[model samples]
Target: MVKYFHNGLDHYFREGDLNKVLSLCLHRFEEHGDLGTEFFIYIENAILKNKEYVLQNLKNMPSDFALRGVVEYGLGCIAASEFRLESTIEHLRNAFSLSMKVLDVFENEHGFCKSVVPFIAKEAYNLKPYDNLKDEEILLPKIKFSKIEKETDFFVLASCNGIYFDRYFEEFYETIRQHNENNIYHIHIANPTSQTEKLIAELDDPNFKFSFENTNRGASYFACMRLFIARRLMENYNCGCLVSDIDVRWIKSPSKIWAGLNKADFGWYPKPGPAPSLLVHAQIIAFSKTQKAFEILEKSNQFLAYKLSEFPSWCLDQSSLFRAVCLTPEAKTQDFRETLGDIETVQRLPDTSLTEKQAFRAFENIEISMNSDGYPILSRVD
Candidate 1:
């Protein structure tokens, strides 16, 4: 009976417009920053569009099963967006509880959507702790670094594979040198080989720090883990930290980003997409050295630690970052776009397979500099 009803619910979503409309709502919520009450109503209406039909078909099978559960979950998300904590908790409980039951029976089944259970469960658990945090405790005035006579004010940390070291490292280092303005750099390599370690050791730059991490669990796990590691690295220092991806090219100095920390504990570029997970890119994130920043990182780690020991690939760290932001009351965050020009950078070259020499030759005649308009420019030099 459970199997039959589950299959029926699947067919309903696949054949109906409700799923499509709901997806559209999720995507557009972050895309347009249109989290108005009307937007919430639109989402609620879409979820309920075929709810009656779905509930009728699944009647007597299991209460609050399948599409009914989805409706609850959708409502919970809307409640969360609207800051209706009580309603959000109640709806999510119903939705995630039902989801767990469904997964217990069908998780091993072929082609089952196994990720949903873990994802929903994580959200449910994380929100509980979030609910317990007091508004006063979560929101606090931003802390500033004292004026110390240090060579560098802050450091940029990045993670990457050793294979791309030669492909992008030089250009990456050069760009940072251009805009570093006395800031340091830290590179975390994922399981570097002996040769990779040796090569990195040859660099005589005192301003750069390097570390290797065990990324066997994959990128998502490493992403979340890096936050904890970063927090530890900043413990003794009175400075801000910027976490970046190695493939990124620094077009503008992060000084503007660092200055943003004066008003907030966290700073980042929010990519247009769904909230909580796909809402922001983890590419470049600035964290000020403060109790608030540490608390947020600690909370983020706690959420991942309670992931039932299963790392679901549904933007694990990104979702946790969002939850951390939400959990912190009045979490002061500055969007880099507010002060800096487009934070976008060319992530990778068109042909990634190019050899290091080939890559160097390719960029030899191209100059990476700012145009008169103050925008980063890449132009061929004759």
Candidate 2:
């Protein structure tokens, strides 16, 4: 069986015999007890099914549902992106509720969950609540992008240079193609470097790419972030821009923002959350070349690059950009709201769906103390 499978790798892929290839892997799983090979086949199958095999494996996990939660979150992410799911609050609530089980109850799995946040974010983009302007809003004739006598084409910027960047390229490219199809976006990549560039190069190869500019500035998050933002602005070719870090992908149609660009006042608002009152700069801003957009981008980039000494090293590019936005009235006062940091906050674990055993186990790792009556309490400690 192993020999047959070995010889048939090309045959299965060439002949589109996915099931046959899967069967061979399952056979190998039984024969060799190799969980790695099992997961390899399982992930592929899950993608085909749109539920990610992570769920199936966890359904029968040897007694680690928390770990299963970890896997489920990853799978949930894959399931979210590959499938065009329903965009209802109930579903988002479901994911958020489930993730709590995984994140809160699995103390033993803390390191594991943290390790996969990037990959998880890629997948999570697929599974969350997607809201768009109402039909009345969308029905309003989209402002034709050509009206402004602008020489600029819309540049949808994404920076995907890290480890999970390659695994999520298929997902990312799907989004790029969708935007491109709308004739509203010309996707460009700012992926400075990663291990899987060769595979990424083979896969559609971005319309534009860049080499990372080393500042010899060590691993300080402050310096690197300044560099990223500076590079994003310095490298932009478009006269207009819709930019975001690679982390928070578009869960729904980005067309609104495309049109929003045409009408945006380019102001800022305090987008505070229930979590904390954090200050944020304009993430998604749009204005024509004649407008202050380019000036702001150039000025912000240069300013952040030099003022790296102002913000803490941990705040990174977003922080630097926030600082720039604060100083510039054109940027700081914009009413434009781009859903930037939304992806990272996705709730994908299935806490409520957990069996009682699963729920109780989660309670153990949930660091916060439970009352004598057994109600869990939230602690300041993470």
Model 1 per-residue lDDT tens digits across residues 1-382: 3333334444554565454434543444345433222232333344445354433332223343333454565656655554465666666666556554454344343222223433344445434433332232221112232233465556777766666554567777777787647676777666677767777778777677776654455444545545656775676345668887666666667675677556588877665432234334676787888788787788777666654143233355666676677668666777777867466542333245445335223333433332233222333357
Per-residue lDDT over 1-382 for candidate 2, one digit per residue giving the tens place of the 0 to 100 score: 4445555533554455555655654565456544232343344344444442333443333333323333343344333332223322123333333444545433344332332222222222212221321211101111112222224445554443344355454555565455554333332233335555575567653344433332323323312342344333433444445554343344444555555444442433233321000133333444444444545555445544443333222223433334344445544233444432342232111222344334223323223322333222332223
What candidate 1 gets wrong by more than 4 Å, as runs, is: 1-151, 160-171, 202-204, 214-216, 312-314, 345-382
Candidate 1 Cα deviation (angstroms), residue 68 = 5.2
RMSD of each: 15.6, 17.7
Candidate maximizing lDDT? 1
List the lowest-lDDT window of 10 residues for candidate 1. Answer: 134-143
Q: In model 2, which runs have C-alpha deviations exceeding 4 angstroms?
A: 1-152, 179-194, 205-210, 214-236, 265-271, 274-277, 281-287, 306-312, 330-333, 337-382
Worst 10 residues of 2 by lDDT: 135-144
lDDT of each: 0.54, 0.37
**Would you estimate the TM-scores of all the predictions?**
0.58, 0.39
